[model samples]
Target: MLRSFSYVTDHTGFCGTIKNSASDFVVTEIEVPEHLLRDTRAESLQKTSEAQLEPSSLCLQQPKKQRTEPPSPCAEGCHGGAPSPSERDPSCAGGDCSASPNKKQPEGEPELRSGLEEASMLDSLLGKPMSELLNKFACDLKDAWDLENNADAATREFSLGPILDKKDRADLHSAVRQKFPFLVTVTKDNEMIVKGNADYRELCQLVTEKETSDFFKFLDAKIENSTFSFAPDGNKEHRKVVHHFINRKFGRLLETKSFTVTDVNDQPNMSIMVRFREKSWSRKRSAGGFQEKQDLYTDFSYTGIKDKKAITYQPMVVKKVTPERLKEIGSKMEKKGMRIHNIHSACQHLRLGQLKGNHFDIVVRDLKHHSHDSSADLKERISEAMENVETKGFVNYYGPQRFGQGQNVQTDQIGLALLNEKMVKAVKLFFTPEDTDDPVNNAKRYFLQTEDAKGTLVMLPEFKVREKMLLRALNRYGVNHEGCTKGWLNIPHSMRIFYIHAYCSKIWNEAASYRLKIYGSKVVEGDLVFSEENDESVSLNDKVHVVTAPEESANKYSIKQVVLPMVGHSIKYPSNKVGQWYHERLSKDELQMCKFRVSPLQLNIPGCYRPILKNVQNLSYFLEGSEKGIEIEDNHLNAPKVSLHVSFDLDPSCYATVCLREIMKCDF
Candidate 1:
């Protein structure tokens, strides 16, 4: 219901109303360039920045103070006002210090040499490629430190594959830091991650000035070389995000392998490898050429979450779709307030989030202003607010549409019920009355008052397909938990996932607000940044990096790079207060990090990260002629006549409503 999200800019926003009519809000999808679409390969490993060659203290010499301790979430204490033991010790002050910021990690080069001996033992066990990867990470760490000092940046995580040996992984973690004191190491699913800052300056450099041809070419090449495989490394969520994005965008054009192997800890660990599925004909023709195939033996193929009601992707046998058929479809869509145009033949179907951006032409109806303020003064103030939006941008909160539109029960509430496995409760919440006089609400009331599903079905309109299905299922199965669950399952998979995603969006908004409140757009230590762009997909297979040291990395990242997690089993919480808030917030919901899955329904929400801020493109605003509905006028004894016309472009999935809310600085 009216949750408050943080703002990026501090400006006296132009107070106004919007969406007075259907024509008031116009949106057009910005198609991705065909050239860019030709090449969509993921990015490669980050190269060592040129700054690494410079003689920086962080790179050349081991800093005496190497941060070794984990950040204490409760540095200020949990229960009483007293600080915890870790907080009391000077060695762990602010959770940023290791052992007194001046204390040497191993005390000298003699100890460092001994640590190297330990490193050698571990390196021998890791094999050449993984060992080389570790070394690469060390170089990356040096580069990060060097870059952080010169320019603020975010960290990128490097994998040392999966270290099956617990002792070896631990030794490597300790020894690697001893050798490269600037680096921080973390273990995830038996894999070692060498945390180093990513060079955001390189991110900036990748943006070329030549837009028409050369820039698109470079961008396409850059994306093509990008990494999508997580054969032996990467966070499961990160891999899943990539996997889901690819799967959703390209259908079943690619294949991935998930290997479940036990580690030294006697726990099953997953190693997934994602690659393009070779065409059957290609495999037959290249028998000799593709000899060295990676062994893809597996325990079981991961089915992921399946929606029983989803339409199976099948080969369509169509000679040609007639113009009359297209017109028929267009007419049907127009009745539903949607228009389909730009008809063309395509080799493939268009997938979600394939667009470059969206262009918005929003018209604000009644503008409220002080009685004493003149039209020119109001225009100046509005112009100033618009400028602030262009410069500082706005928080990219999921707008109210994501929650639910004028409903008594939010989608997330139903999602929470589903997650809690109270299927009957979830079904009940879905059918809850919206306090409206519409036929749908009347049907809901009839269903609630009388347990006659058949009667409710009679009252529902023909357009209410989901409602009718649910009622029919209930009429057949009865109103018990078993019946309700079966009825719920009858709903489309897309709608079920939408409810769940809405719940995720709720958490993301809260987390984003907390982060903004705590840090105020500042990238701090332990903040997360995406190693690759997945176009805001939830199946982010953990391709995220932790900011190891803010002083060295914060300056390198813009507010756009910083992101907050959606909170799931596969995600790593930030090693700071915001991360702590995730736990505290989830605790209130009676949920834990490991409980993000509803095993019975096969619903696994391995959450992904979302950027806190989004910069608008091609923003422009102007005052339009007064509409007839104006209640107040500019010294003309009429209503507010300032009909503000605003236009801007935003990346796909971004909310124009949120952007408008930011500009207006009012709850709409």
Candidate 2:
């Protein structure tokens, strides 16, 4: 059947075309023919019935057009009162075909015309030439004919250009996976692509796992907290950056030479054992606190060296030793006639007592070569040399020890002798006295002057005698004597006269006020009663109110008795019990008066012991009330006064005396 078709060109109006065979197409100029439209419709219906076809195919063809005129389908009865194509079909018969210009067949048939027109419009928009549109029916038929052909391969090859660029490929995969959401997979080349939601999830899981593992490995390598950025495009830039950072930071720590990790029990994660190298040495000195002048024997157990800064001893093990070559060293010593026996003896002595042996290396120091050097220069040179050798890592060696002809004696023994002499002088100065009559005063003077005596005086029994006689003479004349006379006083009277000048010196005049004083007095009832006139004629009643004034007398007085005021006409002064009662009463009254002085409760008392009695009363009240669980109210107006009682007995043999003075209302 001849199928009519129409197409619009860029510069031409719609033109008519016709296809009679699969490959034959021709342009035509024809007027509208109703029979032809009817024929075309019949033929389309026949084609549709002959084969299983899509409803869209019925509107695939267009009506023939006329030449030099606007192409239009032949419509019947529209302008000439004939039945119109709209009347033939009230609805579209096929895909969007109702708009067709042909009026024939049925009302529903024209509906298919609209679909044909829409298809034509779409085909034109697709930029295909009218020839390709004309060949659409044949193309569709050919697709059916080549059903077994590799169409997918051809389609894929054609689609490659648009999909192959980096960005485009990624976008393509994203779109495909988003649309299909089921076909995603890792490619044979390890490239990942997703076609479904589940595939995308799997890809994401793999990526997350990889990233997590990498992150942990990175953290394991890091000693410090770090921040890093990962490439947005799944590149490993962040990993490389972190690796470099870790290596750089930790590399220096690993480079220390003095410290080494000696043992590692596990790879990657394990405890490391480390050892550090330290330089050490020992220092020895003579008992006199001086460095020895001779070479020290070095063979010794490790007793660790002292840290100069902390001045603390650190213990160490001697890992190695390099003493002087025995033959060469011994020969040199023999040339100087310095017996090896001496060195051996010193070593044995140090070993036996100090647990040290001659393990030290010997370095001969020539005095002649260093004679012109100052002491500081020599010291610096020695220190620098020692430091340099120590830094060179030599084995343990002994330092120098001092020994010589005049100096071979122990320095400590000499120090001991000097100390002994000073001690003896100190003892003599303490025991012997310039003024010896008063033994106690002389002893005090000796102690005070001992430091000034130097080491000249020696303590002896004779010196003590001289000290006593001198003290006696000074006591008699009321003079102080300088120098010890204890030893001289032990001599006979004749000899004592001879040593009098030796015992007394003009130096005594300056120190006389500090001299000891002695006195002879009578003691009565634990009190020393001095006679106003040397007559001693006064009776007790006559001396009742005669007060003995405190004096700076040369003589020392002994107190024989202490007397309290009598109460009423009590015999025996009320004995011990009454005295105790009186004391308690006085204390109580004094305490009460003290409280009343500041409190609202002012109590009165007779003369003497008022403060004492009040203090005792207040104290008793406070203690008693506190025990009874009664709170004592604070009384700002009633402050308590304290009273004190003191008594003493004198020693006549030692000439000791004490005086009591009473103070009343003593604040604070």
Question: lDDT winner among the candidates?
Answer: 1
Worst 10 residues of 2 by lDDT: 609-618
> Lowest-lDDT window of 10 residues in candidate 1?
47-56
RMSD of 1: 21.8
**TM-scores of all models?**
0.56, 0.11
Instruction: Write candidate 1's Cα lDDT for 7-114 as tens digits.
Output: 888877656766777577766656555445433321211111000000111123333232222212221111111233343332221111112111222223222222
Model 1 segments more than 4 A misplaced: 1-3, 41-320, 328-340, 370-376, 532-542, 550-554, 627-639
| TM-score, candidate number 2 | 0.11
Local error of candidate 1 at residue 105 (angstroms) = 60
Clashes of each: 30, 94
